[model samples]
Target: MSNSEPQRQATVADSQAITVQTEHGLYIDPQALSAHLPALSYRDNELYIEDVSVSGLAKQYDTPCYVYSKQAILDVYQAYSDSFASLEHQICYAVKANSNLAVLGILAQAGAGFDIVSRGELMRVLAAGGQAGRVVYSGVGKTYSDIEFALQQGIGCFNVESISELSLINEVADQLDTPAPISLRVNPDVDAKTHPYISTGLKDNKFGIAHEQALDVYAQAAAMSHIEIVGIDCHIGSQLTEVAPFVAALDKVIELVQALADQGITLKHVDLGGGLGVRYIDESPVSIADFADALLPKLTELGLKVFFEPGRSMVANAGVLLTRVDVLKPTEHKNFAIVDAAMNDLIRPALYQAEMAVIPQQLPNGGMQADDTKTWDIVGAICETGDFLAKDRVLALAEGDILAITGAGAYGFTMSSNYNSRPRASEVMVAQSQQQLIRKRETIEDLYRDEMRWQDQ
Candidate 1:
């Protein structure tokens, strides 16, 4: 085929298979997979994550498992620390992204803090050896018990979202005879230009307090006997690709900070919340250095400690979902590669319509030819039609082949479910050549381990 010709073109075959022509050769270029995920590379035509072989992981610890690179996670965390080395800051890993105890432990050991949404997350952080003094409790729904537990544990701060939440925190603090350290999560009304479901700072979203009412809220908080206004927080959205929206949001937040300072409510810190996007496919996300460079000057001007709550950018590219192709059904219109992993295993594709990159763990024997490649809709065994991972991917695939779904570290296992009564997948962490089983695959009995029998009742 000519270089100017389209790389992927659809055609029907004798078996009525929908085949797609390759760019130049038969095999899918391994470089395509490794370019974005630096920790993954092909060795002897076999894909490997760090020094461990992908196929080896599947053979030893079954398919439908999550494999993460320990070094990759630390490298990303270190990059964040290095980028902001000139400032007094705290990188709080958002636990909702990947709450696996092992993952939390890895970050905690590396001198990282945590951003928790509930008391349960706080418990996870503590269980993973994360210090309570470094945990910041977020989320709009903080129950009475959640507040009591966090306060008792001596959490760093509470990112209070609403006026009622402020009152409740103050009440709980007053009852405990302690001052509750807080930061009013302000809604700057800046559009993050991300997915609607993940957007928060807009006026329409149910996140922080309104921008106009922020100063008044601060005043209300200052008068409360037990409320201690420590900082100001703003998070516009998640998976933000561009730096413009963040700078725009920060400008608004800077104005509010200046206004607060003018009102004699000087804050101790400012939390420009984390929404940095990662490259799942073709997206050109801003680098950590670039992101910090864009906002650090303003932050330095404020002369307060900085805080970031990054979740996806830290772990998304550090892991992959390893699954096995159980069957392949070719049709006249489209082909389906049924994998063992389902939406219950990784729900991003189903929930957010995300398109994850799926590549083979090993090349086909003797190398594949142009005719061997086919267009496939990589679907799961789940009954729902939305139980798919990637759509219209042209790859040389076959039965029993292991496929690695890239950019799955964050929100992969944390968001998994027991839908259709399928047990959750195992989690493995790899460092160089060493592999450790962090979480074992759930059993069929695990699905109902807490349920009671109707007859017994």
Candidate 2:
């Protein structure tokens, strides 16, 4: 007989058995990692979250499940609150962060306002029982419906992008017979030091009005009696970790605000759009307190109310995506592990090449074996060749195991699509000792809920 003992098979019953020696070699407290999931412990070569094991969640809820921790959400939100406690600020939780109604409702209950870009988002916030009066609308292309909705809701304000948009909003408000609160989304032209796809503060991006022209736009917006210039806004980028860019933008914005004040348009609020990054893998984001300490005093000194639209930073670590391994294979040059969750479910890896911490239901009895622990390209069953989650990941995993993709709470389900006619997954919110199914799993009919296939074609 071999010296090594037979390992416990990975299954729903074995969820807590895998002690996180290291989730992808990143040092994390096993307690903190499993604190949100109480019954989880490492033993017999597997992992478990409380009595309901990782594989167990897969069996009960099926694969490609989205699991959220209420405590984690509260903790992260509280972190932001604590960070900016010393300042006159309000965190308008970017509804785009995990846009799940339940998720939004959770944050809303914690007293978070919203920053919405689309009418659909506005509807979501409302449907989730979010307060509309506290919501602020931002984005360059605000459709008529979006404007009308924001006006009807009487949100805090709209971060307008252009002079034409300002005029259009004024016209809409006039026709609607309602005064629309507006703010100029200034493209501050500062290098946010972030990914290009998410960078919005640059001069060339299709996000905000040029900083040089912001004064004119503000002047024009101020003249419209139907449009009240309540604030000046700028979003440099998303997933940013540095404070220098924000300080730089604030310096420019303060100058403009001073200029506008000289022209008799005193800004009531200064909306510094969100770009704070969170820890996904070893990426070290600035502490919430540090960010606030850097930003709040600057705005407080200016004597203006401040608004922050944070998306990823608030909910990125609040939850994870659970998928079951379908198959595993090895070739001459590499290894492969196919999971049930597809790119259509979480697009960050494919869209932005973002890195995440991937953990399994249980690791093998032996420590990471080089040959067995090959660099696997984690893929999904989606039809597209681009339907991959991770490339060259070294994990000692086997078939039928569950893989927990970290940092999925924010953009995963929010960006999901039915790309190959695949049904969306269910989402569960874990609060206290109880787990609730906030969203039900999709059935075959859900896949065709919007498809009107008339046989006449």
Candidate 3:
């Protein structure tokens, strides 16, 4: 009965029994919703993000827009910063979550570093005013140009995933006549117990060097003149509902660090790459503070600079996908609420089978009957049968109703596409009770803005 065990058990219990009944499916249990989305509330029967009403945002931006609470993003970052205040650490926000320049700008201003996987992401961090020396590049397949670009920018370090990549980076650094900071991303073979699509710390996954070979890799890295071995890192996976996997991964990382020290390969930092999951459905993820409390005692004993790359935990609950019901169709086997927002706007549901809370801005005709509580497959206008935001969702709604799909801040717009030539949606940030459009809705012309029709022969 450790201190965190009871808390974990309680959260699991709460998630199991609590379901806020809606029209057909259940909204996120209020307890989990409040824990994750502290800035959201219902006022005048309308869902609001911070002080901006969902109704008002729909009216102004039209439907199928992204609405975020500026405060929510700040709050989550502050929680991480405050919880580890006593430690030497850097909260390197994973940029792939939501790379809207404004999102990056806000994080950069808050003294957050960045974890980038691509050269374009490196440019975005710089464009958003993030310091070059605070950026950490992580990915398995960084190209020659990627290595050249990162070295030119003088990034903090590269979380090298393979020996080949280390050699390539060394070559690039030598070509540029500079020392490149390197951190071997060791595959700890720990089961993150998450979705297969995201699990990265296993031996079979093509993410990092194997755990047993990490010491040898460190020795190889030390032999390279252009490589400055700075740190050790491992990311198990994303959307982790429990803290045990992270702890397991870190324990292995620490063991390797000691082994490397015995070999005279001293490290500067220990990067516990972030995959802390947020409550999307019935998940009871460890709170950032509790997670830190669980690991800080051991982390402090190591006395090395700590680095984190939290993505979803920082932004998933801060934004909502605002969509409008376009039409309702009922058949013998199913009821459908087709929305204007399609798979091109948010792909998690179709891709990952992910679930999110879909709450109507107002109930159908402001009321619902027992029969009106029919379960509806909330789908998008995309032609694919798989194009859905949520299936068998219970929601009280009308044809023209607006729905806020909660828990969409991370991996939402960043994963969006222009498939079917559908223009992407706009984005709005609500702060201090005021709304500002962060991204403009793409126009039909913008879809073909760069395409040129071939001349007739």
Candidate 4:
């Protein structure tokens, strides 16, 4: 089928049955593919992301690049907006997940306010055409200058973390002669039941104020001359799969909101910081519809504007890291497939022990034969032993074969680095058959352009 031709949905006899496309054939399970990814599918023995061939992108962009489906992102964002359509809510796309200007621009144009952590993120949101009034500043550390910048921009609210940070914001606002819109991020201490590293609501985590101290803190904020308590905020953690923890957290937040209201502190909104999970493997995350169904009623009863700071769920599965196998080594102990993309290119696998689904861009004629497949450790070129992508993955592979690392759109490039002095990869956004290079691949000199040379010194 041509790239411009609309893809026909394949009917399946059973959910597990692999649907064979007779015309321009390929053995693919459409149901299984849809369950994992939205805009990706197999056609003519090649994987296509929104009708744009993944292998074609690898060849065009020259491997070790990030490719995102524009439609996928829009669809996901639309789903979130549609689910909460019944409520007075704002779906603030968390900019920290994937801060690429194009991604930001897409979300901004689609009416997504941003949840930023720093001045730089706020600037990025503005540069991408997002309104400062729709932005919510959030983080543990906010320097005087950062607070001043955000205040100058007239951001919607500040998700104040600590009491000291709250004081700092008030101090900056006083100097600016402006009442800074704020939200005290309360630590509900509700276990998000996610990875410990990503969990932020626990008392031990340095994210928000203790749940018990929220009312007292609000009293403190209420007394501050320059601090305007516009709302309350709480983010338990990232990659949360279940709805119980969210409902539990909301219940606590509601209780606190009522207590504050009783104290004559009527807030305008409630920021239920987002941690909705996406399917990285066999995991069944709560659907956006289900999430809204779980929390919308309580929020409606509260009769306050709602704000969701979704990061991963907005873009994680919308993009992939495209890399080529540079070398294949077979040893008695273990088999290793070293790809050009390293930990510096995508670090979640190393940092969070995240397991991303690695699949070939192009499949063999009749899929992989038993002899052609082997259990291989997909390692990167980085020097660290922890620099690995997938472990003990059974796949039909060869040197020079292009692979797509799924679930890379969120923290993949945003958390990447130039470790080992390796240039960062380029980023591309695919919309149907058309492709656009959102970011250029970094050059070796680009890395040290701002550094003072020893000879010059």
Instruction: Provide the overall lDDT of each model, using Cα atoms, as 2-decimal numbers.
Output: 0.88, 0.78, 0.85, 0.87
Worst 10 residues of 3 by lDDT: 1-10
Provide the lDDT at 274 for model 1: 90
TM-score of each: 0.94, 0.89, 0.93, 0.93
For residues 59-170, write the lDDT of model 4, one tens digit per residue.
8889799999999999999999999898888999999999999999999999999999988999999999999999999999889999998888888999999899999989
Local distance difference test, candidate 4: 0.87
Error of 4 at 105 (Å): 0.6
Runs of candidate 2 with Cα error greater than 4 angstroms are 1-53, 365-372, 455-457
Sort by TM-score, best first: 1, 3, 4, 2
lDDT of 3 by residue, 1-457 (tens): 0111011123345534334444334533333354446578866556778887888899999979998888889899999999998899999999999998889999999999999999999999999999989999999899888999888888899999999999999999999999999999999999999889988888889999999998888889999989999999999999998889988988999899888888888888999999999977567788998999988988999999999999999999888999999999978778899999989999998888888877777644444344456677899888899999988765556788888888899999999999998999999998968989999999999999899999999
Clashes of each: 0, 19, 4, 0
Candidate with the greatest lDDT versus the true structure: 1
The sequence of per-residue lDDT tens digits that candidate 2 reaches over residues 242-297 is: 78898999999999989988999887888888889876654556777888888876
Report the lDDT of model 4 for residue 90: 94
As for model 4, its CA RMSD to the true structure in angstroms is 6.0
Q: Is candidate 1 or candidate 2 better by lDDT?
A: 1
